[model samples]
Target: MRIRLTDVAKGRRDEALPPTSLAYASGEARLALAETEQRPTVLGLIASGRMAPDVGTVTIDGRADAATLRRAVALVDAPDVCDPAPNVTVAGMVAEELMFAGRPSNPVSARRWLEAEGFGAIARTPVADVSPRERVALLLGLTALRPGVEGMVLVSPDRHGGHPAEWWELAESFADRGFAMLVVAGEAAAIVLEGRAPRADAAAGTGTAAEELDDLVAGSGGETPAALDSDLVDDSEAEPATATAGDVAADPAARDGSAPASAAEPAPEPAPAPTTDPAPARSGEHDPIPESADPDPTPEPDDRDEPEGDR
Candidate 1:
């Protein structure tokens, strides 16, 4: 808990400094929207013990060393930083993460923990089968299980399903558990942190003060011109066949010498074809007329069988 970054700057030496400066305390969830390429580097450096901020200080509980910070912070489900292989099972991912974090890496223990957390249904299933939202949730839960993990920095958790607010809610839940939570994403997700909207000053956009990197990333170098009505004419109206010289001369307007100065008089629309009624069918064409069920035209009355003499 109690993570702070004072004028922190991190990025490749050849490139410009990343906009990663800010101070954040425990029980607070902040959103950092860094450039796509630089995002992973910044999150990885903060989570891992590899690199420290170039410009200022990164202190957790008043300690600034990489080893101490690494033990305290965890990065969850960040493919660019550290993600389990697609084929890895849920249990396998947990075991791997625990092992790297210097915690218990027992697969059986990991599986039991996952089952206890209601992941038993997908414990054996591959991580790829898990939905994005479920996967992020599982990963965050796994990060929390790591020994001495006091803080978590989620990279692009909003890339999964559900609204960004939901993701922020999940992060806030972690902060409630006495862990410092920081979420980084491509854009500022609508979040109500600490019962209030994100402060205007808290936003450290991916770009520097002099330039807005969003414009570059969004592929808008400058203001785009609006299209004119003529530029947007329907294809059906604009694609009429060109009039031949003979046809042009035969136009009624051309004959009367009243045609416009332009040689291209609009082609007259073709007249609608007249419709003819279908011919009537003969009486016995293909089907046979239905006949009466009884065929006898004349029937003699039956004599009483009992009276031979009378017959």
Candidate 2:
């Protein structure tokens, strides 16, 4: 069996998931990077044919049949969709999953199943308290039991806080058992896995799995999708680019630009006034009356007329 997603996307332009394309066939495990709280689940849904992509296609064996795809693929532990409740006990979860698989679901049966599956000690433990590695193994094991399930989309196992290699090995084991596996994880997990690929390849003595893993990481461009980084989106909207003081001062056109100085840049300082010396005082002439000082109100008597009358 083969499953392919061609530019599959969900939500408004870059809201939930960016357009992505990937394909995996039976006996192959692939990883896809999806950050943010909603993206992993969204990708898992689209990959498993549980949800339709807003702008792409998902095909099984080169046929676009949602019903058959849904039947053949299982979406495991998707947040807010099929995840076992945090408060639910391991025994309870096991029993429920057993019932879904059309097997005996009584408490005794659940216990026996747990013991047989090497999870007997954790039977009474709350699912939330289960270790990440054990939790993933148990969930994936149970998912494999479901009838008609040939492939699985495991969603956001990294969120549970285990090393990527732990769960990745489990996925690879399932794939080696002829099940197509797709693990939807965050960018951090993908980076860790990519970094460990060389060591893993050496340990396995065959580079096939590591090479395929490298291809998966490379296909994602090894970077967080712009849409998936909510913080970046929020920051761009919260703080717009503005002209700096240096920019306004250096570019005369910026000062005269349509954007107001108060809005786009700081106002420039006022230029100093030009200085000039007053015309040299005229020779032997009283200094030109000060432009600003007021003249005395009392007037002087005419000295020539008064003296002539007395003589």
Candidate 3:
């Protein structure tokens, strides 16, 4: 079975996803570049026939049949879509996926399944806490179990933060087992994989494989995918660049359209000149006069005992 996406794209021009083309046949794992949380999901949705692209076509075996494509391909771990809840235990998630595959979904069965899959230790662990490699392996394994799924489109496994090789090797293993695998990842993953591809080709003595990988990367674009990498940057991880008080003060262009403060407003009047010089200090005595003398004063009579009414 072969799945080909020809110039497939979603959303308006230069938004969401740009026109992308790639193909993966059975027993082959292909990597496609799709930066940002939304683009991976969008590409996975279109590639798996869950969404209709705004342009181009996705054909399975040269036939543009959405229902067939949907049945044959599984869209795995798309954020806000098929991804298991973060708070769900690994066992609980496995059981749910087992149920979807029409298998036993009891806790006991789930635990036993985990044990068989070599993940029994993490049975009680939250899905969110699962290691990236383990999570990707588990999800892909579960999706493969569902009847009629011959291909899998894994969306943004790189977002889980692991060396790309770990999951790529796992996907290649699945492909070796006659499954069509497509990984939708960011430029970082693409770069890592592209660097490794030549080495892999040299080791395997297959020049064609390296050439194909190069073509895939080139088709995505150089240095960045068609989608802006800047948009893909996590807002929490990197603060947006802003003009600080110093920056604004130093950079005239950083200021708003309003005129400069000096130009826009009047200067203040000079502080009133001191009315009188400060009184000189007397040794061992507090100054008798105030610093600024009162304009008029009511003089006090000498401290003499004068008669209240001198007759």
Candidate 4:
């Protein structure tokens, strides 16, 4: 998906531009970093992973870089990023460098070491008088003291002017030797790489490109009235139906094809009166039958054989 960086930075991060991709989504820092100039160092550090991004993830190759890059990559800022000892000569310091390197003993011979490292005459001079590059070289040399330094980064190198060809050729050689580089340049830089700009007509045409999916399907006779189902549900709760056949017959849609949704089924008439014999009634409320209706006149003999109720 193509995320709108502007909206994300302004609406989410609040940064002007993103420091590394992470800060781009920061709801606050983004508002401050959007300019072509006047950027903060934390932004660069965030990109390098020494600091954190406010929004997106940082990756190298395909793996996340925030963890790995912080240790592997070093940033080079031009000139004077250190302090010096006044009591010691350059050679004395270079000889004692082994102590600072965690060796602390069995130091290099100063006279022989100074000559071997191309600082023989200058070795006797105090470090405070040396050029920035000399100090940088000292700092850079210490990186290798760690025993497994694979590479280094130099921001502004000496050979960038009339010697551009030679310097770039050296960079090409370094790349061939598998050194990853990040070179920064000043205003007077002479080297150039060719690039092409997109044609105006092509870009404009693409920008105005239209979508016909909805319109084409709509006009293709599928989304028209004929394509719509008449049986589809209507809005609102249906009322308990009291409608009869005459009311159902008056609906135009029902006449055309649709059914009358609220029409009720016709009520059935009472069944014809059932035929049965008339039943006779009792004379008194408490009596079962009148004595006059007795058909069996004779009485059966009592079971006990005691005549009448004399006892």
Best by lDDT: 2
Q: What lDDT tens digits, residue by residue, belong to model 4 across residues 196-218?
A: 21111122123211212222233
Candidates in order, TM-scores: namely 0.55, 0.63, 0.63, 0.36
**Between candidates 1 and 3, which one is better according to lDDT?**
3
Off by over 4 Å in 4: 1-48, 65-67, 76-113, 126-139, 156-177, 190-311
Scored by CA lDDT, what does every candidate get? 0.62, 0.81, 0.79, 0.40
Error of 2 at 24 (Å): 1.4
Question: In candidate 3, how many clashes are counted?
Answer: 0
Model 2 worst lDDT run, 10 consecutive residues: 196-205
- lDDT (Cα) of model 2: 0.81
lDDT of 1 by residue, 1-311 (tens): 44556565665662434545543445666665555655555655654455666667665544566777677777666656576788988888878866765777798878877888888888888987887667877778877877887877777665655566667777778878887777766543534333443531264333242232222322232432233224435543777655577976878876676754554667778775455853454453433324755645675654433344431
Worst 10 residues of 1 by lDDT: 209-218
Model 3 local distance difference test score: 0.79
Candidate 1 collision pairs: none
Global local distance difference test of model 4: 0.40
Better of 1 and 2 by TM-score: 2
lDDT of 2 by residue, 203-304 (tens): 222436435344344445565445546755787689877777998888787778755446656778876545676566545434556879886677465543
**On a 0 to 100 scale, what is the lDDT of residue 101 in model 4?**
51
Error of 1 at 218 (Å): 43
